[model samples]
Target chain A: MEATVALIAEHFNGALSPTFFELITFANKLKIVTQAKPTIVMLGEEIEEVANKATHFNGFDVIAIEVPGLASYNPETYKAVLKSFLEELKPSFVCLVQTSTGADLAPALSVKLGAACISSVQEISSESGRITFLRSVLGGKAQAVFSAMTDITVVSIQPGCFERADTGACSGNVNVSRRAYRSLRIQDLGVRPGPGCDLLLSEAKVIISAGRGIRQKQNLALLFELAAMFSRSAVGCTRPLSDSGWLNSGSQVGLSGAIVSPDLYVACGISGAQQHIAGMQGSGFVVAINTDHYAPIFNHSDVCVVCDVIEFAPELIKAIAKYRQVT
Target chain B: MRILLCIKEVPETDAPIMLDQASRWIRDNNLHCYRMNRFDECAVEEAVLIKEKFPDSILDVVTVGPKRAEKILLRALGMGVDNATHILSEHTGYLSPFITASWIAKFASDKDYDLILTGVISEDNMQGQTGPMIAELLSMPCATSVIFERISYEERLIYVEREIESGARHCMKILLPALLTVQSGINKPRYPSLSKTLRAKKLRIPVICSDALLKVETRERPELIRHPSKSRQSLILEGTLSEKALELAAILDKKSLIK
Candidate 1:
């Protein structure tokens, strides 16, 4: 039997998530490492349209499991359905997006199948007939390369790490199967919109983002003042600031919040954790001002200014004002 | 109600960490400080809140790590956990999530706890696996990234709201005897009170060596640990604060970003 690499598709509100395409990229990498046939497994209600869309990708066999009552994601239903099907298929590898759902499911699923489970895998390589997975550890200060010992390996691929795979002109066949899901213990009440729905951050041309290094909640005024200097600028923040209730949820940027690609992104006091970096890395011009010279955020920036954002913000504004008058 | 909160000791978030010789793991000797993981702090607070509500509830906090990990357990105790257990692994290097989960599950199974709690993920490994894996090992329902939870003792269920992508919340209900990996911001963890700290110092926490648990071999082994290569070549600004600011402003002006 040919080894199979299963790419678990993530969908919500009747649309495939961007992570689905990223999972395809992961599948492509696994093909290079294991020479396995790629298979896409999608679980949802009335997912035939998304399943058909997935089949357009070349060299992938699609399995669409429709559980009638599961309109939204229920971990219990997902685990129950995938467990029975994957046990029979016995895929050599299973790939999931490194999100809340994937992180929760992968390890538990591995326990059921007795497979090796690795989370937040950023890179994969095969050397001398052995495959190794690379992941960030110690808050992205270091990377760890891991090798699996079990027959089947389950991995959660980090988002924004791999480029989306191109389907080109070729397509593949999809097999749609309906499964009955009965969860007496858990029920999905659908998704509820969170508070703070400001669209300013997403629409702004320039974003001045703050992080924990901003020191105190009162210091946020410095960021706001700097942002007001520009015509179409907005104040944004990392998860910590928002978690502290200093900013609304809408102004937050990271894996669990808005992904903005502004014309210019000025990170003030931001340490540039992976989650925050994933949200703003696509900005056209990136500048990071931080007190810590070794902050990881500098690695992703175009210009790095090592200074306390509190002191530097006022000086930066003065410099900009002086430069404008001179020009 | 008996609640088991799983916590781990990790290097302080801002601690300077370096790759060890042979490039396989971090150099522990150089790390000057350690504390309860920030995410696990939320879990400990949540369990404490539940204990506060029940008043009769027993909150048992457990950690798996070397001797240095006992400090975090005591810290959790100082935050109001009723009891503490430490699974002494003795080694500081990378311990696979599977082995950790297996050890935790073995310790938790016979206790018949009403609920198990853990952090969404650790600051060190950031795997976010142990809670759900322990649940699976014990055949219990599990929830991850739970931002809010309300326990209904009468109904024997817990209603939880899990944070998903794009700030969306997925509300669900799970039966008791389940596991929840809590996300940060659920609650503000309190500082250790003087009286509680004094009391915790006198409490004797039983240390169960991991060797006493069912022997589970790690299925995944870390082969290397190194600094991540930067994708962009960032030009670090040089000189004093104002000089750097002026240089940055010039660059921004040249790009027509600031006018």
Candidate 2:
């Protein structure tokens, strides 16, 4: 049967992240009734932006629904309006690429619409009529596959796993429609920047963070000097450092603060707490250095160093400088 | 104030889960079964605490899942809920979350519940959207990640402590008929007492069929494909303890891993 899958293109200042190429690629792989095209539903101008962006990667045809002024994210309004659209279209399958916010809305919207939801899917496919979804569980230690028996199934694809489609251009029709639901009473609380927030915490390409072993706040400069050498990478601290006021609230990285998945995470003098691990766990590559041989971070890091920061920090920075001069 | 606590039965969080040969879904273990989600147990305990405060108010616990979901309702009743309801159906796999929310919302809509409470997220899916979703369907106000709750009868308002960024806490107040999604570690959910378990066995649970709850519309199927094999690019460190430590530090520093 022909399927109409809606991928709610999340809007960030009327634009979409290029990473959503994973969603487009995965959605294109589904087996549906032949002779009918898969319809892509997007809300707001970002839908058009995504449609335009997706064209650059693949010549896939996407029909977009643009709801004007659909700025910011609202689950209730989205679900309400989407429910009405599903009632009219009655697509055979629906899919969403999992992001922090999309993950929250996927299941609830599916329930309100009476659809089976397959969430956090890293892989998806169908044979005959049955659909299978795959994702990792227990902090990426294991893979779990889920299947749905319903005629209509909804899936939320995980981010970062799929290849982003190369930018390409395609032609698509744009339809502007009003969301069916009444205006939401809830207003978005704008992002509030806190005080003493080091500019680095918000904009760092790389982060070198210290944990409990740093021992003293004054010693932070030792780490800062090295951070300066590394293309102005930012210095951050674990909860203990922030709690002790060794670093400002903005510099704290963990469950309670910024859940940064940076390009590279360098953890120093830190005994990795479980909460701390959750925050930095998303890094592309993790290297942890701590004197305590039993530091928990070693379990989670790509590279682990059991060394005292005081002696190692100075010499390591000096050695790097010397190595750079020779190389 | 009357309260409705929605619970769920999920795969044990710590268990080793495997997929079946179809590569379509989780394999069923003949010997093992599901348990009431740990976080929902907290919601039940919170409702129990409120019932203890206003002994005159009623507490109705409801859950929607397959036949096995009765386990959650039975456990809730044994924990001191005045009544229990299970919206029974075989649609438990991928659709369970949505079906459960719809069933609970339908069950709660006609009833007079001063407050609706559920776990912020189930350990199984861990998506943390059902409470707010149901609240939206019912057109009720909803808030998530609450650690503590207080009810003011005189003011007709409920105040709750919510966890925030940087281990901070904030208090929020909402009128009755509000929904609160609870965070873990809010309060310990108690084990059912032997006497209570025995009494629970005698309580009758009304099972509502899926069609009776709400109308559902099905949509797209996710296309599934084979998973790729991953190669670990690993670097092994070896030497005397101090030497290894220093070498590792040097490597990290050179890589700019240690600032």
Candidate 3:
């Protein structure tokens, strides 16, 4: 195992995603387990700045594949360029953050390069001398540990799994490679900014979020009432609630939704899927209410109450009201 | 138009599931409590919607699973799918997404499907690999996490809106012979109509032994299934429902969260 290359993810709109820093951490971690050298890879048009910044920050050599894809990420183009470039490098590991782009790219790239592909990995463990990637399966109900069967492995690290390690010891060298690509099968149209983008999510002091456990649309009033109990609070929801039209997309909280770090997060009926937890785990304090005792929400909660949200929210609302009155 | 949809049969999310630690695979498959993967239900609905708009199009739904997997195909058929193909396998254990995608790709390659669609990720595996793998195997374009799409018959292209981080979306124009993995909430999946359900029941579906498909080399395998590592205190508040609520309120109040 020579090099563990961490590919920096760029947002579809060409902005650099923050997940790449975590990818560097994961790459270094995997480097330790495999005794491989660590490298950083970035793809975009004129990415010298990002590459150099990462180089100086992580103290790892950067491979900057400069292509003319700034408007949007073209999967076909990425696949074409990376297949050729990575084939030459033949690195032991190719690490990417499990964002929408990474999730879409990892499997296809693995098939192209004849590498073992693991998706949405949240943790890494070494037993004896062998290493395995651990990821949640069955919708966060359990965990699965997987081992690569091939020489080259492509692993997508789940977002929010690894804390970005500070690395400014020394600047490494950058290797620039310019490539040209023409897509015959696909064309970029553009991006539609999500509707109902809630600025309140970022500014709110408290967020009361709903999930599938809320059961029905009408039950959401309880969460709204709970949110009203606190000042500067707003109602948020998991993807399912937004998908069901019970709430707008802007009010949704998760990896693909809004990412908020309020002082207090009240999770109602949320099962605590990694996608949902990744967004709100930065909250100062957390409380979760659910009927399922094994609900994953408990894992991230400061206080976990094993009761139906429908039953619990009203009581919490009443208790908070009474406490406020007494004060 | 010829469209192909891939689906999976998974344990119902609400079912009481117990893990078999020795085998490292969850059990209760012996029972009949199974349903289509929720993400795939959205795909099934999307396929039906496309079929409705293009009434002359042929909609084929395929699943690679064990005997019990016929459930998804039947449901797809009941939802107005024209054809159902079951690549049968008895491997009750976990099947790598690569292997599953390879089998379906082999079956669909010669059919020359104009479009292929599936759920962004299966609830059971959450790998989100099969759809893109199929497209790559067939040398076609691919997209994932598609929140909305519309087909342009004249241009022979499918325009897609793929959701990215924070609900932002990237829209792309995919050539006809492309694959799209639909995200949840792309559409509300509808239940089967009584007439369609009865008609689908009477129709015998075509089944192909998964072993018959071209051998696919799997890149990874699960070594163990363990309980997820806890990231917080995970302290369970034990008491009656009201007592638990009041306790939570007290905890928040102690932190001065309630004012």
Candidate 4:
């Protein structure tokens, strides 16, 4: 009997997370390499609609398990339930989006099931004998190819790595069932709203973001000064600035912060880590400034200035202001 | 109360990467240019904060790496961890997260720590697995990406705000004897005091050989390392500094991005 490749469906408060379809598409790619088709495991309290929603788009067997005690994602409840469920099913590959939830679940699940766990997987290469998965390392400065010798492997795929499967029609079977379990050590206190994303940043037509390349916290003032030029503009920073407490958490932009799609984005001194690139990639026009010509940010920008961001910012600020006055 | 904090050393986020036709970042010339994993610094800071509140708390920091790994341990001690352990790993390149977690778990299981904490993920691997894997190996409840936490001393519950998608934080209350992976930016990590650093330097920290311990070999291996194709390539403006700046202004104007 051959094993299975499975994707754990994601839902937030019973509404299906958009990443579910992307997971389906990634799993489909893995299907060709592993010679095993993918199945969808939908678990939560009231996931019928989300599961039904999934089957509508993706044609994979949907195993919808409603655990009576789980209203929201509690890692303990998830590990307790999914471990046995997976043990019985024995999937060769368990795939999930590399969201906070999946990041929490996959490693523990892998340990419980004695499976190998690979995370933030961005690409899959099949020509390399044993289905190797590629993921970023050194903050996306480099990439690594990983493969599992174990029978079971759990992978968390980074968002935006694969094209999402489109929504259309339900072609697969949806098995709706209930599982009985009570969480012992963990209690889900539901969710409180995250920091208010300043409307200035979220609604900005022109957004300027900075990173470590700014040299120091004082350089952030330069980024702000540059932001003052645009009619509707604001300033943001990458995780380093946020982590250093140089800027408030609200102005941070990345997978963990604001995901914005502004009309124009100016990235200064930012190395363009994968997360930061993902956050700002949706911007219509992007210009990046950095000292490191080989900086990964250059790959994602529309216009790249290979210079120290600090030196370029003041000049660009002056140039833009002067140009605006002339025009 | 006893707390166990797991730490890791990683390449500085800004060092020029040496990538070959390549998979992993070859840490050849850049071996000396590394520091404590940024996220783990937050974990150590959080543990220190917890200890400050509960003065009776005993905090221990541990790292699984080579001889150079001790520097991070000493730094943790300087940051106010009560003790440090160096689980010396022989393999220098790409030790599996599972193998790392198992060894740490083996060392931690009998210590009966009331709480355990680790960085949400290592900056290099970004797998974010060791903390949760240790939690599983020890059968302890666990939480990941924890940004804020409080101990309800009398209730003996830890209330936490775990970071989720798009800045949303999922709150949870976990019973004691649990594990948490601390997300960065939760707090400003305190710099090591000179006195503490001197004291930490004088202490004889324990170094346990990883091979001496029961082995949990890696089931996964790195087959190859190569840079992925870029999604987009920027139009680099070739010129002097001021020239590039003027060009940027023109480009933004051309794109109608400037008002």
- Residue B201 local lDDT, model 4: 94
Deviation (Å) of B63 in candidate 4: 0.7
Candidates 2 and 3 compared by DockQ, better number: 3
Task: Report the candidate with higher TM-score, 3 versus 4.
Answer: 3
Q: Rank the candidates by lDDT, best first.
A: 1, 4, 3, 2
| Counted clashes in each candidate structure | 0, 20, 0, 4
- Residue-by-residue lDDT tens digits, candidate 3, B40-108: 999989988998898989999999888888877888888888899899988766788889988988899
Superposed model 1: Cα runs more than 4 Å off: none
Question: In candidate 2, how many Å is residue A203 off?
Answer: 6.2
True contacts kept of 4: 0.83
For all candidates in order, state the fraction of native interface contacts they contain: 0.83, 0.10, 0.85, 0.83
For candidate 4 chain B, the 10 contiguous residues with the lowest summed lDDT are B21-30
- Ranking 1 against 2 by TM-score, winner: 1
For every prediction, compared with the true complex, DockQ reads 0.77, 0.13, 0.77, 0.72
Model 2, TM vs. native: 0.62
- Reference-based lDDT, residue B144, model 4: 93
- Of 2 and 4, the candidate ahead on TM-score is 4
Between prediction 1 and prediction 3, the one with superior lDDT is: 1
**What's the TM-score of each model vs. the native?**
0.97, 0.62, 0.96, 0.95
For model 3 chain B, the run of ten residues with the poorest summed lDDT: B23-32
